[model samples]
Each structure stands twice: as structure tokens, then as C-alpha cells.
Target: MNRSTNFVLAQILFVILLLTACSTEKTASDSEPKKKEPKKETVEKAPTEPEEMVKQGAGEHYEKVKDLEGDDLDKEIKELTKDFPKDMKSEDAYNRIIAAFAADHQLAFQELEDFDITFEEVEAYEKYSEEDGEEKKEGPLNVVILLDASGSMAGKVSGTDKMTAAKEALKKFAGGLPKDANVLLRVYGHKGSNDDKDKKLSCESTEVMYPLGAYDAGAFQQSLSKFKPTGWTPLAASIEAAEKDLQGKEGNNVVYIVSDGIETCDGNPIEAAKKLHKSNIQAKVNIIGFDVDNEGQQQLKAVAEAGGGEFQSVSSQKELFDEVESNWSKAMHDARINWSLSMDSSSVNWSSSGKGHSMRKVYSKMLDSISDEFELLRSVKMELYNQKKMTNEELDKLDKLIFSRYEKLREYSTNKHDAKQAALDKETDRVLKLIDENAENARVE
Candidate 1:
């Protein structure tokens, strides 16, 4: 073959050989199955939702009570309210509407063993001292003033009737009451006949004018005018009745028997005192001999011990007014204090340890809100109590005070978003720590 023809023929043979090899390789590659892609893995996650946020102290309190005074008829209807049900009540709703009311007010309900909380309203008085500073003690007082309704007390005692003097003393006592106070008043020797042909032994000389919040000057005076001192002095029955009424209502519940003369009930005074003492009624009784002789004093003192109240004698309206005012003031103060302490204790949550302390801080914050309300309440109460009673102007002032305080409180509560978030963060940390600690303890155990 020529050189050119041999090169061409060589090239063609090389090309054919390359094409066959290429086809075989391509066929081999195509004949082999394609490798499958590896399956993608998936992860499951737990579902969760965010907790609801609430205002710290955003709850409704007494929005209506402002400068309210008690009339004689409606005196007992001052405080009343209903509480939310636990199971059915929504936590969010409670936090929004009732948490403030349920918050503590710094009052503690716990008591140490072996202590009888005394309910004595003793005002510190000036007295000469020896070694220590001046000594002050509750002075002993036994007083009694017979209210004469035999068409006499209706007359004036210094241009303001005898009844007026008594009522003024009572009103003053109510007005000048401390946060804690209690008092009692008994009217007797009225013009109601306890004696009749059929009523041989039945003798009820006096009527209990009012019980607890029933002390009103006008009503009492009106009652006196309507009734007259009829039959003999059923002093024993009156004293006995007073003793029963004073059972649950005394620091050292006492009796001040105001009688014109003698006892008609066969019930003996000294014997009754002994019986009352025997019944675990630690009461003191005193007597006031109203125009009575030494014999009368002896009888009164004996009866006073029986009923567990003191007794004193006042011949004129002046002495009566003064003594009543003094005694009532002391009694009322003591009673109110007892009530205040009780209320305080019942409403407060006491803390002892760390966890308790934290809980207490929460309660304390709540109480702070409550205290603000109470402060406004007390101020409004005082303002209303004065001013010949309450006026619309006074009411407006109270409303303003309450509204402003509430508004400030509401702002404080509403701005607790940051705090709530913080609390949640803290809680998360706490729960984690608790879980870790518990797990560690379990491992150790």
C-alpha cells in the first residue's frame, strides 16, 4: 500500500476500534442499574404553648364603699361580701378580678401556745414612779347611772335633755374610737309594767334597747320617752340579763347595773356573781349606788361580781354622762382592738423559712395593695364620721381618693409584663434545678 493510503486505512481501523470500545463501555454502564438515593431522616418534636400573662395586682376591690355611716336601723349591715368558687373559678379571671381582695393585709392568723390574747382596752395614764419610769395602769372604776323615764329624763340636762347627755357620751365614744374598740349600754327602770294580776312572779323591769351596733342617741331617747318606770325595780333580772349578753363580748366583760332602787326578781346578786365565776366567765362586776345608802352599795357590789361587770352610782346627769363616756371609751377601744387583731391575723400568711418567705413576699405585695385601699377607706371613714355626718362633697372626695389609688395600683399591675416574663424565666431555672437536684438525690439514694 502507498504511504498515504496505509495511513488512512490505519486511521479508519483506529477509529472503528475506538467506537466499538466506547459503545461497549457505554453499554456496560447503561446495563448496570442506577444506585438509589439514601432516604432522608426526620425528627419528632414536642408541642408547646406560651403561658398567659396577667397584671400583678389588677383586681377589683370595694369600689362603692365611701364615707358610709351607720344609721340606727341599718347599723348591722355595713360589711358583707361573697367569695369566688375554687374549682369552677378561672385562675386568670381570679388574678384579674379577685386576687387583690384575696391578698393578705399583714394580719397573721397563727398564735403561739399558752397565750390568751387579752382584749382589755387600757389607756396609759400618768402616775408617780419610784425606780423605773412613771408607772401607768388601768385604774379601777365602778359606775352606775339610773335612767329615769318617769317623765323626767325627757326634761333638759343643761338645755340638752338628760337623754341627750347620755347619747352625746355614746356618740362621742363611737367618734373617738381607736382602730380597735368595743362598748355596751343598758337602759332600765322604764315605764313598762312588769307586774299584773296574772304576772305574779314574772318581772322584767328593763328592755335591752340595742345589741352591739344598736346604740343611737335619737332612737334610745325616743324609746325612753315611750316607756315609763312602772313596777318595782327588777334589778336582779336586769343584771342577770346583762351577764348573759356580755358573755362573748368582754376583755374582762363587766356589768354596770343602773337601777333606781331595789331588786324585784328573786335572783340574788352575790349568788349570781359566784355562779358566773364558777361558769368560767372571768368577769369583774362593780356597782353604783344611785341615791342609795351603804346597804345599797353592798348589794350592788355583790351583784356586780355575780354578772361579771362593774357597778357605779351617779346621782345626777353630769356624773352619769362623764362616767358613761369614760367607761364606753375604754370598752370600745378594747373591743375594736380585739376585732382588728383578729381580722389582721386571719388575713395574713406568715412565713417561716426560705420557700415560705418567697410565698410571703408575693402575699406581702398583695397586702400592700390591700393596705392602700384600707388607708383610703379609713381616711374616708373618719371624714364621713365627722361633718355632722357624711355629705355628697365628702363622698366625692372619697371617690377621688379611691379612684386615684386604684388607678395607680392598676398601672403598677398592668406594667408587670416584664415581671411576669422574669418570673417565668426564674420558674424555668427553678424547675430545672429542682429536677437536677432530685435526680442527683435519687442517684445517691
Candidate 2:
């Protein structure tokens, strides 16, 4: 045991370490706090583990692999994986496996994006528009009032003339209509006198006093004043005029006629009223016969019945006022009902278009894509391992990188699903609330 003997033994130990450097396995004994490391082993640096190499080059490695695209990505991945590294290079292994299926990973990320969810498809929601002082009226219902300004309407009811009482009641009724509704006022038989000579002129008299539009108190009152009771009762002619006014107009339309008698001037009121009701407009024609005789009442009622509307006979001014008020109440009720029906129909299909449960489907697809990516990377790793291109250590490192990508993307998919679901709920509730507010304001008492 001299100096020569010590030098020869050290040289043999160095050769043993070099041979074992290619295959080193880590034992748990050195990792456990209670276990003491043996001093007989050499002070040489142990081979870096495959998992450690992956953890060390995590952030920058993932970014490099993610940015690679097109022919450049294809060339780099093919060249790196053509023959796996002879040396332990974790970066090359990550790039080769991860970059190969860039398009797949891109698609998975794209699915994670939240799509737009809205109530635009719902009819009521699509048509709803409200602003203070400025009208946004595309109303689904139009009310056309046909005033009979013939000589008989000049007759008396409660000492106040029929024409005066009717006009006053109508002006108040129109003023109280829901802001979203359109009002049209038409007058007939106001041009000629009640004489037989003016009969032809009176029968042909029909004019729109107030054009169809949003209810305006001032304009509507002015329109009502434009006509007076002066000519023969052209009841059939007035209703026909209303049908022409709403000829091509869309939505639920109605014609209300205030008359004191049946058709005069030899016109067929029943046939004319029937034709208006059955036309494309499908307008209901209600009649309010004020201060009329038994014969006039019976004939007026028949005309209304043929027109698919009710007839109300009134001898006093109070009856006229009450009837118009009833019409207003019914209009508000119908508006509420229409809105509720639209909401119910929309909710039935909300899962697909409104994203109620569709978010879960999107998330499920994202997870499947992540699994596909995980398996794809493993396939590349296995191909390298199957060929024995790289050492077992480098291939193990590539497996760690693939697992890392799977977990990161899985977390991302979950977060995106949660965020998207929240957004869908928020937007849906906002639209529903807006619908409620509009319906509530529709009551114009």
C-alpha cells in the first residue's frame, strides 16, 4: 500500500464511474431524511434525471413548442425526431413531440373560446325597444278608430250632442293608450248634407284623419277635430275605408266604429263589414251605436257580428266612456300575455342557442381533445423508444413533458367552461329583466 498502489486504484475507480454514467438509477435511501449516505461512493456528479430536465425547462420550453407552425414546425420536428439524441437533451425531446401535432392543440384551444349567447332569436326580445321621450315603435298591434261623422251623430245624448261626447271620450281613450301601440283615426260621411241630393257624396266620403303611428295626444286630438257630424251615415263605406288603411300592414289590427245608425245611402253594411273581417288584414270591427232606435241597434249589431266583433248600444254618455276604458284594459292584458308566451318558447330552446347546458358539451369536447393530444405525444415518444433512437433516460423525460401539457390544458378547459357559463347566465337574465320592465310599463293608466 504505497503511493504507486494508491494511484493505480484511483485510475480504475475513474473508469468504473465513466462506464456507469450511461445508466444511473436514483434510490430512495439518499432522499429519506433518516437515512445516511454512504461515504464509500465517489464525489462525481450523478447523471441528471429525465423528470428533472423537464421541470427545469418548463416555461420557455412550452412557449417554444406552442409557437412553432406550418412547414417550419414540420421540418424542425421531423429533423429532431429523425434520430433521437445520443445525449440527454430534454428541450429537443419536448419540441419534437409537442410540435408535431400543433394543429390539434390549436383546435383544442380554439374550442375553449366562449361563443356568444343571446336572445336575438326570440321575437318579442328582437322587437323590444324603449327610450324616454324618443319613440322606438315597431308595434305588433294597431288600433284604427273609424268615427261616423254623419248627420245622425249630431243627435243628442244626455243634453250633450252624440258627436261632442264621442269625440271627447275618444280623445281621452287615445291619450291613455300604451306608448308602444299605434293609433289610426279615420272619418267618413262628414263631407255632404243628410239630403237625398248629397247621398252619393256622403256614401263615398272616407278619409284618414290621423295616420297610423305612435299615439300622440296633441296630434290625435287635432285629427279628431278635423271632422264633424254633417252628412248621411255611410257605415259600410267607413269600415271598407279602414280595411284599405290597414291593407298591407302587419300585426294584430282592429277597427272600432262609433255610429248612431246602420248603413244609409243604400249601401250593404253587412256584406261590406264581412269582406273587411275576412280579408288579409283580419281586422275585428266593433261598433258603439249611441242614441239609436231599436231598428238601428239590431242592424248595427248584425254588421258588427259579421265583422267578427261585439256591438255595444249606449243611451247615455257614461256608457260610451266605460266602453273605451274597457278596451284599454284588454290591450294591456294581451301585451303581457304575448311577452310571456315569447319567453316560454325561447327557454325551450335555450340549452342549444342560449348556452344553458351547451357549455358542458363544449368542455367535454375540450377534454377529449386534450386526451388526444396526450396520446399523440406519447405515440411520438413510444416511436422513439421503439426504435431505441434515444437512451431510455431521454424518452422518459419526453413522457413527463407530455403529461405536463395534458394537466395544464385540462385546467384551462375547466376555467374557460366556468367563465363561459357565468357569462351566459348573466346575459340571459339581463334580457329577461328588460322584457319584464317593458311589459310592466305597458299599463298606461
User: Each candidate: what lDDT?
Assistant: 0.43, 0.68
TM-score of each: 0.35, 0.45
Tens digit of per-residue lDDT, candidate 2, span 192-272? 898999888988898898999998888888887788899987777777778788878655777788888878877788988
Q: How close is candidate 2 to the true structure, as a TM-score?
A: 0.45
Worst 10 residues of 1 by lDDT: 120-129
Tell me the deviation in Å of residue 344 in model 1: 18
Candidate 2 has an lDDT of 0.68
Q: Please, what are the lDDT tens digits per residue for candidate 1 over residues 231-264?
A: 4455555556666765654333444444434565
Residue 3, candidate 1: Cα error in Å is 99
Model 2 misplaced stretches (Cα beyond 4 Å)? 1-139, 327-337, 341-445
